[model samples]
Target: MLSQFMVLFGFFALVLVSIVWINKAVRMFDRLIGDGQPAWVFVEFTALTLPGVIGVVLPIAAFAAAVYVVNRLSSESELTVMQATGYSPLRLARPVLVFGVIVAVMMSLLAHYLIPGSLSQLRLRQDEVSRNISAKLLSDGEFLHPAPGITFYIREITQTGELRDVFLSDRRDPEAPVTYTSSRAYLVQEGGGTRLVMVSGLAQNIGADQNRLFTTYFDDFSYDISSLVSRDVVNLDEVAFANTLEMLRDPEAVATRTGTTYGTVMSQTHGRITAALLCVIAALVGFCTLLVGAHSRFGVWRQVLLAFGLLVGIKIVESIVVAPVLLNGALWPLLYLPVLLGLVLSGLLLSIASHPGVWRRLMGRGRRSAEVAS
Candidate 1:
């Protein structure tokens, strides 16, 4: 049972992560490619995002694997055979609980290390890419919008680093939009700033009266374009980029760095712990939900559906229960409500399974009510 659960969980996690990663990769492709970045940069950005994606879907995959393994065993009568050999529900659950723990460990590793490290690297790479001026402005024969309200184009470049046939549109000041055309342009750096120097250029703009076009011809012109492509790398201050242990050690430091309150920092710390614990709850709940039904050749599909609903319900409860933690950090322990609820529900299911007569009588009562209504 443990082997089956692991195999299915691996497959499910792979499929779910791929679906989500591809969807995000599309947006990454547009941003990187539009900025003249290479294909490898886009790939790296998408790859760095995978750990978080895996963390998000790991619990669901574990639950599906558990439900599938349990339902299949029931359909094959292996579950019944085991019961005939005096296997109590709890005893039968031993392998499933071990599988849940394995999944929980994987989630914990992701939450604690992989996700935070990946996010930090991703932010660093993004800052480097943003500050790559040549990549942002060096594309020839293609109009580039490096910043909003500005368009730049270069027809060709010489082997000696001279720009040819440059066309620039500056609509940043909409009331006085201007266009500059030059036969030759050179990128110059002086006083720790970059500028575009155009030789033999004509600048056109609307006249003050707004009734006629005005053009000014110059032998040399300098335009400051450093603002277009050079931006300071914003600090990576998100709660997700910080390790949970760091937050626990000094919540005030994390709160100040991330620009969040003490309650929000504590919420994030406990949220990571609860996220890993959710994997255990999901797996155990799925297995125990199926165990509540007797083995049947027809399959316990109803139980499988019920288990899925309960898993979703647990997630909903997780979000709802965490609201208070965000308000008061001392209430962080309440974040475990979803896990506790799932365990209690699993225990109830096991108790019902251990007593067949109780389940039968409940089913009997349900049937009598339906018959009376008919």
Candidate 2:
């Protein structure tokens, strides 16, 4: 059973990861390809994002595989034969429990190690790519919207890489729109960001509310493009990029380093731990929820749906727990409530599956008492 569970888990996990990876890759391609990036760059960037995607898909896949495998066994009468052989529900679930533990350990490794490393590398690469403004952002005869409310255009690019007839419009401030036109400009890397140094440029500012326009002419002017492209100040790290050990070792220091709070850092550290444990809870929920029902030739569609509903409920509890924990570091332990609840629910389901005759006898007695009363 453990072997079967592992095989099914791998199959389901691969299928889900492929679907998610494709969707993510398509969007990433659309964004990077438009910036004149090469096919290899596109592929590498997409590949770097896979570890984070796999971390998210692992638990869901484990649950799905557990439900499918358990239902398949039940439908084939294998589960019934095992029960007849005096195998209790808890005994039958031993293999599945081990399978869940294996999945949980894998998830822990991903959440703690692979995801953070890959994501951090991805961010650094993205920042590097963004800093190469001449190659990525500037294109001759094309209107480019690098950021919301900002548009740039270059009429021609000289062999020396100088931009000719540059036009820029900034409408980030709704009340004031600024437009700049330059006869010539050069993109220079400065202070870890791209700067457009324009010569012989005229800047025009229009005020929407006051209905006023102001024009300024200058021989040289500069504009920074890093903030426009959503690139963090180069070398600045975020909490998400920090490893679990770092975050846990000194959450306060991590918070200070990442420009976040202790609550956020501790939440992230504990969240990763609990997120890994959720894989085990999800597997148990899927297996035990199905155990609530007796065998049926028609199929266990109802039980499958019930298992899904339970999983959803657990996730809902997780969402509810996250908000408070994020607000207060002291509430970090609340994150594990969903796992505890799942264990309790799974235990109840196993008890029901184990003593099917006891429940039937109680129902029969109730029916008899009702007849006598009537």
Candidate 3:
């Protein structure tokens, strides 16, 4: 159990760190979009969607860690002692299978429920930020003050994408509408508010939608726009936010009706179930490998390679199986068969490897007892 726990713990930690680093690297490309936002903003955005990242990386890491720990134990002669004490491969592997079951359930929860909900929230927040009329949208060299409740201006935009020559108008209160114009402007976000600073501008008020337009200009203008309600209105049912109970209650309804090909759905479902089962498969494979001679130089490395190879093979098979299912709805459940087969095979192999010596010793003892009785 300790060995199994260490393997699972180490794998989870490594995968989490790797995911964070990968997220950072992936976000660097966002800077090229020239959104005038700091790279850290993109990083934070990625961080908010990390549950999906965890779902993808956890199974691979678990498989690798299982092989690694088992190999380490085999190399150190600990596995040999356990085997001699009549601890069959199945007995040693039991902890790993147990761990796998736990992880599988957790991952299932994450993939089908938690990740989708979190992603929905992240998307909603992103939409809100993008739609917000703030300093981020201001550009230079454009006559921006087009109408009431609007202000716009432009200057020679810097290569770094900063705004200059900002203008603004506010008709939010029809009774006392205000307008301000400036030669230069900068945007700042603080305390849940977005503010624009205009230099060398003016302020005035014009009549509402009438010929009586009164305008006054100012040398400098400063205004604040609340960064609230920027999010696009979305219906909860349209978003993917089903929890486990919800999914179980209505699995068919939980699936999106985007006219997805049967093959694609099959593939996706297969991938999800396979990922969950990998924990059990990895544990069984590791336990069987541990039954080899402790002093063997290459045994551990061989098992590690085998485990990785099997994992890759499973992924490839899943992709292949899912392709047909995407084209035809009939093949959806078939995708799960490979994962089930892998688990069964691993269990059987572990059982055989763990007890070869035990059976031989028991048979010898039985023969000796029979001869004494005769």
lDDT of 1 by residue, 45-143 (tens): 998999999999999899989988888888888888999999999999899889988988999999899999999999899888887766777788999
What's the TM-score of every candidate structure?
A: 0.85, 0.78, 0.66
Which pairs of residues have clashing backbones in candidate 2? none
- Model 3 TM-score, 2 decimals: 0.66
- Candidate 1 Cα deviation (angstroms), residue 132: 2.1
Residues 1-374, candidate 2: write the lDDT tens digits. Answer: 88889999999999999999999999999888878777888999998999888998999999999999989888998888988999898998888899989998998988888888888888888887875666556678899887789989999988898999999999999888899999999988897777899999999998787898999999999988767765457764788889888887889888888898888988899889988889999999999988887778888999999999999999999999988888898889898899999999899889889887898898799999999999
Give the clashing residue pairs of candidate 1, or none.
none
Q: Which residue segments of model 3 deviate by more than 4 Å?
A: 19-22, 25-44, 138-163, 166-182, 185-271, 290-295, 351-374
* TM-score (C-alpha, index-matched) for candidate 1: 0.85
Residue-level lDDT tens digits of model 3 in 59-113 = 6666656666677667777777887898777677777777677767878877777
Model 2 TM-score, 2 decimals: 0.78
- lDDT against the true structure, per candidate, is 0.88, 0.88, 0.62
